[model samples]
Target chain A: MSWESFFQNLSNGISLGGLYALIAIGYSMVYGILRLINFAHGDIFMLGAYIAFYGMLIFSLPWWLSLIVSIILTAFIGILIDKGAYKPLRNAPRISALITAIGVSFFLENLGLVVFGGRPKGFYRPHIFDEIITIKGVRILSLTFYSLVITAIFLVLLFYIVYRTKTGLGMRAVSTDMETARLMGIDVDKIISITFAIGSGLAAVGGVLWAMKYPQINPLMGIFPGLKAFIAAVLGGIGSVGGALLGGFILGIAEIMLVAFMPQLSGYRDAFAFLILILILLVKPTGLLGVEVKEKA
Target chain B: MPFFKADHLVMRFGGLVAVNDFNLELQPGDLVGLIGPNGAGKTTVFNMITGVYRPTSGRIYFQDKDITGKRPDIITALGIARTFQNIRLFTDLSLIENVMVSYHVRLKSNIFEAVFKLPRYMRQENAMYEEAMELLHKVELDHLAEEKAGSLPYGEQRRLEIARALATHPKLLLLDEPAAGMNPNETLQLMDFIKQIRDEFDLTILLIEHDMKVVMGICERIWVLDYGKTIAVGTPSEIQNNPEVIKAYLGEEEYA
Candidate 1:
């Protein structure tokens, strides 16, 4: 491949990796604290895109306002899902919560189909995102630049919240031992709700950016990205946020590079994620950054 | 009125009655010990008071508040803190982080302020970090504040658990087996440490200990349980000399 094409592919890969990291952080965080897989996460991503789409086209809101509204609404829905579906099962077996997560995923998908309809709609990106910047010989989309910058900001903010703040300390404590966290006067349920809100909000951001890149929106649009990001989260380490970020970048760059170099392998691109998942599980079950945390009894 | 009280607390696990109609009262600055043979449901009584397991029947009160079956965090916020039998520290977290977590319930700033790095959040966070360091200093673990709680040796882990609990500014502290794995020398130090904390913090402490030496050395009063029933309650020397307590400890055949 020519140097320019290689640079283009690298930019594309990194941008895609940013989206995966955004989505994967949600998965890793919820898993870290609650030990729940949150299968509905992908559907929440889809809902975000649709909300932004409708906000712009139907409500005629400004792009920024619509994006903000979508994020807030998606975050609210995320908290509602936890309060309704997962909170009741807090003391239930872990398997029960996992199964309920799968059930919640289906419920959201069908809910989307009923509400948003089955047809695919075009996602209208703001004009700024459509501009192409020629950097030396390489052509980079402004959307890719925005995605990378926005993703970096979110990651930094998340790290600060998790490591620097008292709430973050509570989150780490809760993840370590819920009963002990409670004994420390940390409100375990509130921490959990906050976690869901943050995770879902980030997922919404990922979904909106994802729609801009692909320029398509459907009820099922989140399925591929969702699954792929989950694979990235696992490949990095399911319960570690840094691991998820690493996993996302690796998966994204690898996918783009593999497809770019070997056109014939494009058909198996989705399969590649599952293969990575299995290999990571077999090789280092904790993912790259995951410490082996004992499940609370 | 008692500073802390458990009225008719009962705990049952299916067919087994773990603790039966247990009752206790502590005045301010009381240092009491609960002791029993293995499976005597001593920990179960602790569980009920700390809101770990809601009593099958009974109420727990602290500072004249009817705290029966309240959520554990609420109970903790009401100035009760506890350490565990197995040393439940946030093992993966640094010692400072573990103690800092205790300040969470008392934090005035909410998540929005924390996430946005608002001034109130920064002020409170700095205060919390300093207070946590002070707590570590009290436990003599301040030098190792950056180390993971799990990496600390067994005796230090116990002290860290107490430091973490103390960071909540609790008026009442429950310690379950605080000296379980300690040697005699360490146990003596722990007795002094426990008494010092009780006096320094103005705390009413209820302890469960297998170390009779530590209990005899420091506790003002002792409650002995066998098969979930309180067999004796008195000064430490009285507990040692009680016939029923002796039988409970030595077994019926040995007592005979």
Candidate 2:
């Protein structure tokens, strides 16, 4: 009930939302172009965090370099996934690609479980991001500032890429009509691969920041955050990037505020998020920013 | 070297031979027409040449190089571009942006430059913007460059499609039913527009049309298909006089 506690919760909620937004952008971007749900995207997030973890721990690289290295590596991994699992199924029925996505997801999760071991370990907290400051009697975690700053930076870059650039034109065109894009001389596959690269790269940042917030390393750590972010994507009208960000912050604030206002419902936060999604679907069908894209008959 | 050639093309689906041994050749700067009734495999033939469908048996050559089985984008890069039977404008994009998508193939800036908005990216983007607007102007759509393409009137959308295709710097352009839904006034303007672009761009143009007036008026040479076979090829007057072509269009009673 205290204003101080409310502000603290709000801060934490926004930080969490920032991470969710990043991952949701990944989900939305891929879905925007391919209309594929990309169930394996969450696993890619897990892979990213793990990659960064080993980059720092095994290679003894600094956190910054490890972050960059993890992002680049994960991007290629994304392209590899598209080539390996999704590309061949492109001409197949939509359901086939969807099923393969789930399959790829399960494979990665189990791969993580076996290779990384089942036990949870403490996530390495880079010292600089461990600092906490108080503002007007409300405590602020440094990770909050870091996550928000990083998310803001990436979102700006994304806006430029999606709206202001040539490749972005190709992205929108491919999403509109893949065949027409090809006829127009846009390399559909290359655009697709770049989409995965950008989406997966953003997920890498989300994973790193997410680990910093949760401070737990486990094979299945991505499950909850990934699921939550995917919900955010759907809630934000699955194909719109700005919608994802809005959906993320909305979902984040709603969850934190729910638990804050009623401790009794703390365990129900996840359920509440899904509850919001169901309501949006029933009421609007299209997410807040989703335009009804008519399929040509 | 033929500017464009599709030789002995055949496309079969299960028991149906959609296009049987269909062939076409275009000399540089020629405007050709393909006309057939519905299901006559005109569009199917277009698909084979543009890489939308693999011909069961055929050879497609462009600029003397065999381009059969190449992907659509590669074929496009070899200076071929096309519009869809149903307009395929990037509906969400602004009219100018639609044209810019066609320029994607020629853009030299890489992803890093794009994301960072480096001088190189800014330079190319500026150039692309100017060029895209010019293309829109050709279609008389420059004033509405900021509007979503899907929001354009039916006739304007068709014009935008042609403008977008031309932005690819194509040596050969294929338009599938470009005047499909146009009013007679729009169709007349389109005929003139098509002729203008062929001369202005020095392009080889191929079009599939059911509109006999437009086809007969503009096409220097017309090829007709009946039941997936080329039934006639000649000047418009010759095609109109050909007994077989008349029989193909109307039934046996009309020939009597």
Candidate 3:
């Protein structure tokens, strides 16, 4: 492949990886606390994109405001999912919660299908996001830079929240031991809701970035990205935020590079991603950044 | 009024009655011990008192408040904290961070304030950090405060649990089997450690310990349970000489 083409793919990969990382952090945070895979998280991504779309078109809101509204709305939906579907099953078996998560996933998918229609629509963007910039003979979309910067900001913000603050202390405590955390005067339910809210908010923002780059919207858009980002979470170590970021960039770069390097194998990209997930799970079941988080009960 | 009281607390799981008619009363700054043979539901009593389990019947009062069946965290905020029998430290977190989590109950900042690192949030967080480090220092684990809780030696992990418990500024501290697997020498040091903290923190402590020396050596008063029923309650020497206590520990055949 020519160097220019490689750089183009590289830029695409970074921007794509940013979305995956943001989404994967959500997966990691929720999974970190709940120990449930949250099969519907991807659906939240879809819901986020839909929320953004409606905010921009039906309500005629500015892009930033729409983005904010989408994030808040999607976050509430996430909390609602936890309240409606998962809270009742908190004392039930792990498998029961997992099954319910899958149920929620399908429910959101079909809900989107019914409400947003099955046909794909063109994703709208303001001119600022679409403008192009060139650096050293390498042409890159402004969205590429935006995604990278935004993702970095969120990453730093996430780290700060988890490591540096009181709410974060409670969150980490709950993630470690919910019962003990409760004994320490932490409202576990509130913390869990907060976790869902944060996870879904990031997923919503990630969804917007995703749609901006893809320039296409469908009811099912979250499926591939969600599944791949889940794979990234696993690759990084499902519970560790840093692990999710590392796994995301790796998966995105690998996906883009694989397609760019081998045209014939592009069709096998999904299969290849799964293969990577399977291999990583087999080798390090803990993920790259994951320490064995199991409590010594 | 007594600082803490458990009135006829009982716990049943399915057909098995884990604890039955357990009762206790403690004055402020008193050190007490709960003793029992294995499967005697000692931990169940702790669980009920700390709000980990709801009593099948009866009430728990802390400082005249009906704390029975309240959420554990609420009880913690009401000035009660505890350590687990098997060491339930936030093992993934560093020793200092583990202590810091207990301060979460005392933090006045909301999620947004915390997320933004607002000035109010920063002041409280800074105070919490200083206090957490001071707690670690009290336990003499300050040097290893940066180490993960699970990485600590077994005895130190117990110490960390105490430091974490103290961070809540509890009036009553419950320690379940704090020296379960320690060597006699470590157990001796732990007894001193326990007494030091009780005095230092001005805490009323109730500890469950298999180590007789630690329990009998330090506790001013004692309660004994066997087969989920209270066998005796008195001073340590009184407990040591009580015939019922002997029968409970040695079983009926020898006493008979």
lDDT of 2 by residue, B1-256 (tens): 6778889998999999999888888899899999878899999988888888989998999999999989999888889889889988888888988888866778888878887778987888888889989898888999999999989988898999999899989999999999999999999999999999999999999999988888889999999998899998998888888889887873432321
What lDDT does candidate 3 reach at residue B36?
82
Worst 10 residues of 2 chain A by lDDT: A288-297
Tens-digit per-residue lDDT, A1-297, candidate 2: 899999999988898888899999999999888888999999899999999999988999998788899899999999999999999988888889999999999999999999999898777988878888888899888878888998899899888888877788789888888888888888999999999999999999998888888888788887888889998998988888999999898899889999999999999988998898889889987798888865421
Cα shift from native, residue B89, model 3 (Å): 1.0
lDDT of 1 by residue, A187-267 (tens): 899999989998999999999999999998989888889899999999888988899999999999999998999999999
- Order the numbered candidates by DockQ, best leading: 1, 2, 3
Candidate 1: list runs displaced more than 4 Å.
B250-256
Candidate 3 CAPRI assessment class: medium
Query: lDDT score, residue B117, model 2?
Result: 76
lDDT tens digits, residue span B1-256, model 3: 5788999988999989999999999999899999988999999999999898999999998999998899888899999999999988888889888988876678888878887769998898888899999988988999998999989988888889988999999989999999888998988888888889888889999999877778889999999999899999998888888989887773432321
- The residue pairs found clashing in candidate 3 are A185-B73
Model 1 chain A: ten consecutive residues of lowest lDDT: A288-297
Q: For each of the candidates, what fraction of the native contacts does it recover?
A: 0.94, 0.89, 0.85
- Model 1 Cα RMSD, 1 decimal: 1.7
Q: In candidate 2, which residue ranges exceed 4 Å CA deviation?
A: A294-297, B250-256
Task: Supply candidate 1's per-residue lDDT for A9.
Answer: 97
Q: Pick by DockQ: which candidate is best?
A: 1
